[model samples]
Target chain A: MENRFEKQEEEKQDWGAYVKPPQTSRPSQESEASAQSSGEQLQRFEPRSETSSALCDIVREHLHALVENDGAIRPEQAAAMFAHLTICRDCAREFDELNRIVSVLNSMPLSPLPHDYSGLIMLRIEREMGGLYPLMDIPPNLATSSWTGEAAQQTSQSATQLNNRSLAGILSQTALPLWSRVVMLGAFFATLLLFLTSAWGRATLDATLSTVQDWLHQIAQATAEIPLLGAITAEAFNALSQSVHLLEETYLHIGANAMRGVFLDTAIAMGVYFIYQGRQKAKRAG
Target chain B: MRTVTLVEQSDAELVRHTLCGDKSAYNTLVLRYQRQVYNLAYRMLGNAEDSGDLVQDTFIRAYGALASFRQDASFLTWLYKIASNLCIDQLRSRKTRSALSLDSEREEGREPANENRCNAPEDMAVRGAVQEVVHHAIQNLPERYRQVVVMRHLQDMSVEEIATALDLPTGTVKTHLFRAREMLRGRLRPALEMEADGK
Candidate 1:
């Protein structure tokens, strides 16, 4: 009994009547007209089958549904009663032909959607989600029906139009070429050696330093000029004090530790000068 | 002009707004193309979670690289390229890992049952069996062929659209679709023969 039931189940699995509507290849008006005419032709003429009356009745119903639906016969309907349809050659032929027509009809596509699909799409647009394009103001005149490549291209082109240069460019300039940096170091040492070894160069250096100090002392009038001159003067004084501190520790016979406070004093002055310059620049720019 | 405007703005305008930091405009694109991106990822990866993440990642990466986007390529096409490359990378990584991954395991488990059940009854068990078979068969297809076939049939994309999106020639898209279909037809022949024999 179990084997028999299994066999019956297997028999029911037959796809003799199961037909998927041919995915409509085209939905041309002419093709639709022809499908209607072909359907009418089938309606006017009933296929004759030398088979059981019940089987014939099934075929007629299936055929009528196929015509009315323009070939949208279901696979479930076809598979349900394959036994009768397979034996009747005429019905099978008619079914196969109709199935082909339905495939084309199925390809016709769904109905025209409402105009608001675009609006619905607009509502769903995210501010942060454009894959390659950030959002901005688009002119009201350019809105349209479908998203075309031309439009995407235009938007992508526009998104990159702003100038927001980053600080990385300035930082990258700090990386000097090896040869030039080495040359600069060599020139600085050469000038220092010349100043110390040559009595005339040393006198000239002392004279120039005194003149610079006098000029620095005179520049107390304008607060605006303080940052510009003060930054340079502070940097010069810090370097001079650092060298003097080293000299005092090496040869001055003074308590070297006493100059610790001098280094700190120079550093603080440089820091204050830089901070003041930064604030002034910020205010001016603002 | 009136009809087009009544419907929506041009894609170019939308892209322009997107570039100008109009956050909503970019969202429009995301919502418009997320399904396509998701579908491609799903077909390629055969895992919903991975596909979803891949789509999101693709969008994120695309956003970062938006400044370099060329105007000549279709936006969706550019996006597909990003999504496809990501899927391919995921697939390649899966291949190198030596362990049999979840996607593979699902394929291995489902393919045989699907083969057995396509001609089976319409009951729940049979329906599940057929669905598994469909998924398994599609999942097992070569990555390129699998993408083309899904993009064509499931997504209802035209060969031209698929070609444009993938940056392949139309001929290539058609060929891939044809070969993919042939492969499916062969895989499915057993069920057809079974149905034929039962009759």
Candidate 2:
């Protein structure tokens, strides 16, 4: 036995070379009292099988109920069972021991990790997948753009407008939920159509457009003095300006009929969003 | 728009992102549950090397099968299912190879591993002896009993969760748990006595 223990102690020492040290705790001290009292409040859960009963074990019949941890036993039965344990010293000793084991197991501190496995696991995953997956989709940035690439100079005003919309679309999708986007965009176009139907609506559109244009210019100019940001902000402002110009021209070309289509599309989107809302609510309720 | 940090995303959201080919989202998931998985494997397999290997395999297997994961069900329990199956396979394979440890192959009527070592409470009251004894005692339990006890008691998995993970009925899981504790009672009785001695 001493040799066996010596071997185990050696093994534990070797294990400590990689694994963190085990915590110092006495299992007996953990949950001694609450086991019996909690047992009294629990509902009785008699096991269907007594197959585990050894020959000569008299309290084998009550063993399952006597040490029941789950609330399968009723309080009255538990109390009576506890009382019965007192009558049988052997059963009482078993109950006390079982309770100690439960408490100790319950309070057993989780074994600590030896080290962060993230870097190694991630390294293996990256090799397995053949590339590093970026933390999130890389946001559009002029800073990271290839200045030497032909695409930078070749990007036309229309291409920039498309790129601007693409960026906006990505950000909108990421930052806002579908319902919020639907509500905001649908309401904006619907309200715009409402305004366009009257004489003030065109002015309102112009005002909103100009306000947006001015805000872009202000941001562009304010950041222009900051050296590195000046180019990106100027490019962004130009894209927005072109987008606003395209919007006004499109409105003029399509006339009031296009506004009607906008209203119709907004109505459909709103309907779809509401139906989505209802389904989500039902799912959560279920 | 600010990018949502990996920490801010829910498990479901992470799963969705992973399915969408976001590798980092899966990493977030691995980092979140690796400790739990490693500990589960350690308790089940009884070694650090195998448990560490199992943790990596669990995550990799989970990622490979993420497409089939039912969004409505639990992510952690699903991982448990994978981990438990792997553990059983490893144990069975070990048994097949005749490499199963003597402690693991313990018969019900056999002498306790430390019976002679712990003849008296005073002899058993070494520092960390209770945990060490309990650990060995758990290692002695039959595989099925060990799985249920580790998942239900150690991992804090609900009965329903254990049933789902092990593909057993809740009633059967409860039976296994009770029998496990019953087995533990005899082996661990010494530790409790040592504790009662306040060592």
Candidate 3:
């Protein structure tokens, strides 16, 4: 068997030059089962001519075959083709390269849409088309239009009573422009003072350092007894620790103030500013 | 009352009805195209939430612009053109916004390392590294190459279909695919080597 295999391998290298007939011109009706029983199959496996590179062309085409889903070459005629690739280093490398390309391509991070994606999309579509609520009309008993005159009058009386009872209800309808002005003035002063003290004045950092320094110093002293310090070195360590504390305090204070001033407070001021601007514009237009 | 089944009606018929003041018919068209729209946007954007919003915006815009669409063009093609143009606009805006964010991060001396870390792996470390390299490589590709690569490889659109969708010449589509493959092949060389070793 080994000898036969070696003979077959040698025949492939030398048979690369056969005058191959056109593939389509070959007998098409040579069914697989019939070819298996007849000696015609073995004749088909005979090596190509020793002068033609038809076998090499087939082998290169097999490179594309390796990239295909099955990765298997078919037909008894392809036996000689495989025999050539087994011995040819270039063909083997080509096969390896094709396989490598596919493997790497598969390894790419492809985030296909979520699995329940179709269902979720359908759900959203349904929601958008009509809300989850069932579309039923109000029953006649509950319908406002069906109410008796006395009942309607009582409903209106209760609504007016409810409306009259609350100071907010009256004030909301009444003109409170003077009161709003006073309130705006108050908010302006408070925002101005808060911004100056916390941001520009840096008072928050000072206050926080004064608060946390005692705790920080005690902890530093406790840690200073460790071997790395070498000596009490209190003055140097204390100064170093104080500076660290100051740095941390400044960072926290600045972050907190920015959160307040630039984010929350700025939003508030912008709202107030827009209201003020709108009022001014209305007055000018009026 | 006869029920107008969406499936029984052609898209152009639905649009005609919508133009004739049948709001439900227009909404039906939105429902029909929303999936394809969302998939296209998501594949284009690489993020799901943004893609969903884009799909909604696409439908809303399509509804608003439905009257202007000539009946000569297929409704799907018209909608696709609108969606594609919006996606291009979105990509441009996102680029500018990303640059601003990067500048802000640099100015603050705090790099946004965690941005890339969201999709980072935890246990599959080796696979994670390979995925990271490919992700960055894809991200680094020129926009045209990236778009074609995603459409061809990810969406599995045929070259002809992609050309039709993008309104590019078929040869241009093929060239883009070829270049994308070469660029990706170069970037994934190490992974290719590992795969060859059966690792």
Candidate 4:
């Protein structure tokens, strides 16, 4: 029995070498050598007793746990299983094969996700949900344009418009409290009034109100002063002058119209106030 | 910025918000699990389109049944169970279709040509082949064994977790896993030996 125990210890050492190959400079080559060695270990193993059948049953029962735990069997229990594997070639071969299969399984690379896989899944779910909820649309800038290439420019513009519309939709939703909405509107109109009526605003407005020719002359003078800006900057300056001229024309047109429509504007504001008051009264009554 | 904070919320917190009729919260749950569910489906069904369909169906089913979901149960595990059951159904239907199709034999003959175009390195190709063989072998196992194998190996669930997910005894789960591994080892040996020899 002592001799048998000594032999078991020797076989266990061999099993360790069989499981863990020597480290080498090349990882791929080391793995190949290990695989070959493991295969050879399986081939050379020999069964020493007729009790192999019972041992095989034990191996089968504990196999999953052993493999799952990465063969870190406790010393006491390892003696029996390792002894059985050392003497019984069939169980040993099966054990080696199980280890190889598991290593391969664990080493298996994950398959690449399908193109737009998440998007496709989400789209399907949205479709199944009766299209009641809008699916999260891809941002125009991020959406792949490879299919249409340059033709996507037009589609991207529409996508941008859709994004803007969605943003507006969210802002209009009843998520904001009434008090917050009122505060936001008040702040917005107050800022607009200050921009329209302030001294700095009026001075800036008058400065931008130059005639088309005068704007072009000013742009040319600015372009001459910044010679390092080159032809591109000059073209940019010319575009800016044209834009300012258009803005000035638009400002004058609006000013003329506003002067004639003061009474109408007051009437409209009173109408809106009355409508809001009536709705509040109706809501309170209900 | 708000989205970043939303994404950082725990699954339980998201689920709570979802229960409170927050649609975007449910969307967060979907985003969190979509990749994992899709990958699981792909590994089981071995096809992107079918996997995608399974993922969508899984989410929709989960959403519809969210009210019944016990808060204490793992949301990921629950989602995986749904995906696994759907994958099984998909595999069953695919098997029926393949058995009925006369061109399946021809398709099998063309498989080598398709495999050659996998566009991977030698080690990667071997790994891919190993995975394919394992997946095919798994698909051939009995339904219970297949489910246990997927949960144990692919989904990386522990024995107890698999048992809980499948509503099986832990012993049963282990037995099925052992049996599945045995079957897989048998199917994979020749290919593995060839791979070893080639290397």
Candidate 5:
């Protein structure tokens, strides 16, 4: 096997030429598999014509950082690279160059700031923010931390209270004009209505419902291993599936498309909801 | 002592203070991380002025979105994410505006201005802001590869941290870093030869 691999490797000129060696090398996969199954050690041959060079590529990647910092490559791959380096003068030279490159990269100086931009940053923040937040004052002294514990508590209470504002207040924070949002919302609803009322929309809704039902059933099955939780999950999934089936039945009577609109609408809605939730979470944490 | 306590407050605490309507807390956060963020930006954008501007933009954006930050996560990692995205966006915009100055930089062997003078007597030309040569080599790489290289090698960010910053799976991050270094090895061969000569 080893002799054959070496012979194949020697014959290949370009890297691309050695792709289909296994067919030529092996008598048949069934004979090989059956031979292995008969309690024989079959050497678990890889097409070494490729992997010998492939190992070169893999190990070269591993040698990107000489020491494998942060576990750059798996231990086995690293060991392989180290072994290859000792035998292959070319890989060793490449490794040396790689090591020098990394060392040089590490030796680079922390770029000096032209000046301490902290003062300029604070001043810019103050000047630009003067009119934006009438309620939230720019800290009195940008250079000093004058915010006492008591002030933090009181201000935080106000901040928490701030989260309770109406949806309009949330909408106001966004740069989108009210008119555009209204148009978008209206268009969304219209499209949703058209999907639900149309035949193609009905088909889409039915397909989507069935897919969701399958997912819920699988989840229900997974939960069944947990005893009490599984029973509850099974029941919940049954109800959900029944509801989806009922919707599908209703869609058959009326109209709807493939699952396309559902995906498009759900994706858009999920994007908007996640963005809103992220902001809310950030606000609460902040 | 009180000042030290404020200065040393955990990022989460500072974030909480900022959310509580204390602008000072946000400023404190900025002061703590500005230099670090600036360093990352400089590495990514390959220019001092833009990196400086990105530092400010990162802080301001972080400040605006402070309420959205998860306290459990490292604030610096989160800041790096913000700075990294801004840097990539700037890099993309710049890519369309003009060709990278790599060829010109190579011809000039332009060194970084105002960078600390190389103290290591062994082959300063190969090791020093002769950094500009390397930086330009880095600049010449595709943005995705450029980002991972800067984050991993230059910023000293762990692979996991880079994975998080770039929203990539760890395996993919490793591949990019490896391939990026492989691409870089050939570009940086001259420096290694220069080092060999100095030896």
Candidate 6:
């Protein structure tokens, strides 16, 4: 990870590149020499001249102190800086630029508040306050009620028991292999079929089937007696049938789309795997 | 039915009322400082949504710890301290989690369309560009310098107030502010010059 200072240093280097050309064009040999120097000594031991690059550095350091102190530097230092700026064109220009930048920053407008700023904050505070003291708003009468006390306790106990029972049921269901469950269901159905094939069981099944058919026939006859009702019922049944057909079509379309996606994914995965393997092989050969 | 105007209450008066079980007094306090706190957070975090959440969290934390608040300290400075700490924590966590991408920073820097209410489109565009450049420069400052810069320039805080909030010496805050501004001046010079040339 890059340290924040390292990033700032990189930015400084970039800025130096941008600002160097103007300084280099100056006719001062000492400016170029100071600019070329490296390490910590560059800042401390660089030779100063009226048009030298180090002049800008000196002016900048003083400018920062002056600006931060709101021009309240000692009179002697301020006079010296002003005198230098009057004599040095480069330092004066740099000073004006730095001052302009500071003014611009200080004068940068504050963003306008959102229209409902206070309302939103109050809402949030209220919500947080409610969370902090949940029962603060509850009336004293309701706070001491039996329903909120003993009844709540009973409800909680019942909920716990229900949760435990449901957990046990889930565990039991998962304890058996899926195939075993299927086999058990199939065997039960087979035993029921065998019992129905016997005389008494067959008789009971036939009677129930006949009763369902007779009820359907009666409903159809009553509907037929009212032609309007019969037509509406027929239309409703047709709509229901169409809905079922549409649902089946949708299911098929989704399944086909899912299969296509899976195939595409597998192909991409295989291509990546081959590429990776080829790279590994080439590495070994090299 | 005795009534008093909430806006008339001083911070100390409001704190007194809040401690005495009047929630409205606290609400009044939130209303008073919400914008400053939000603007500070927004400038620090550079995301409006995150800043909003920080503001809400700061107030909630302040409410919870109101009992320990010292009477001698300025309320705004105390609130700023909480917000600054939260923002620093966020920045540290973010640095640890992943490097911030320039693309995401650009995206976050885009203001909401509705928020731009300036009448002159050209001037607004120029101002926006300059603001973006300046914001990027500030974001690039090291963490300590960045905090002082945001507090002083963006938040319009006094040096003493900032020193108090950050628990730093007055001279140290001044030094950081100076360095931060110098770095910003270097970074913003080219872009601002271009804008000037274009004009």
Quote the true-contact fraction of every model.
0.17, 0.35, 0.04, 0.30, 0.26, 0.26
Model 4: per-residue lDDT, tens digit, A132-239?
A: 322222112323434354434443443334435654433323444355466555545434333333334557666433443365556566676675545554675476
Residue-by-residue lDDT tens digits, candidate 3, A64-105: 433342324333334455455544444544544444544454
TM-score of each: 0.40, 0.54, 0.39, 0.53, 0.52, 0.51
Comparing only chain B with the true structure, the TM-scores of all models are: 0.73, 0.88, 0.69, 0.78, 0.81, 0.83
* DockQ ranking, high to low: 2, 5, 4, 6, 1, 3
Task: List candidate 6 segments past 4 Å from native.
Answer: A1-59, A115-286, B1-3, B99-128
What tens-digit string does per-residue lDDT give for candidate 2 at A1-286? 3221221232232321221112221111235464444343332432223421231153455556445545554443344344344333344456556666777787766899876777777777767853322212322233333334433333222223333454343442243455576577548644643554333564756657666567656766776677765777577656655566566666677877766787677778778977986787466334
Worst ten in a row by lDDT for model 2 chain A: A19-28
Per-residue alpha-carbon lDDT of model 6 for A1-286, expressed as tens digits? 6322221232122221122223432222223243233222333433465445554566556776655545345544454454445445555556656666677778766765554355665677677664332112211222222345544444334333332454332332233434545555554533443333333444666644334335434544555557645866445434433344343344356664554465466557556855875676466334
CA lDDT of every candidate: 0.51, 0.63, 0.52, 0.59, 0.61, 0.59
Q: Scoring each candidate complex against the real one, what DockQ results?
A: 0.09, 0.19, 0.03, 0.15, 0.18, 0.12
Candidates sorted by TM-score, best first: 2, 4, 5, 6, 1, 3
Rate residue B12 of model 6 by lDDT: 61
The prediction achieving the highest DockQ against the true structure is: 2
> Model 2 clash pairs?
A42-A73, A43-A72, A43-A73, A43-A74, A44-A72, A44-A73, A44-A74, A45-A72, A195-A201
Candidate 3: which pairs clash?
A: A16-A52, A17-A49, A17-A51, A17-A52, A18-A49
lDDT of 5 by residue, B1-199 (tens): 1223457566766776555445666678877888889988887777788988988888777766665678789899899999989987886676467555432343244433422332322244556535777776676666687888888878788889989988999888877877777767776676555645555
lDDT of 1: 0.51
Which stretches of candidate 1 lie above 4 Å from their native place?
Answer: A1-286, B1-7, B99-125, B128-132, B190-199
- Summing lDDT over every window of 10 consecutive residues in candidate 1 chain A, give the lowest-scoring window: A132-141
CAPRI band for model 5: incorrect
Off by over 4 Å in 4: A1-47, A52-57, A70-75, A117-286, B1-4, B94-128
Leading candidate by TM-score: 2
Which sections of candidate 3 miss by over 4 Å?
A1-286, B1-4, B68-77, B98-137, B189-199
**C-alpha lDDT (0 to 100) for residue A177 of candidate 6:** 36
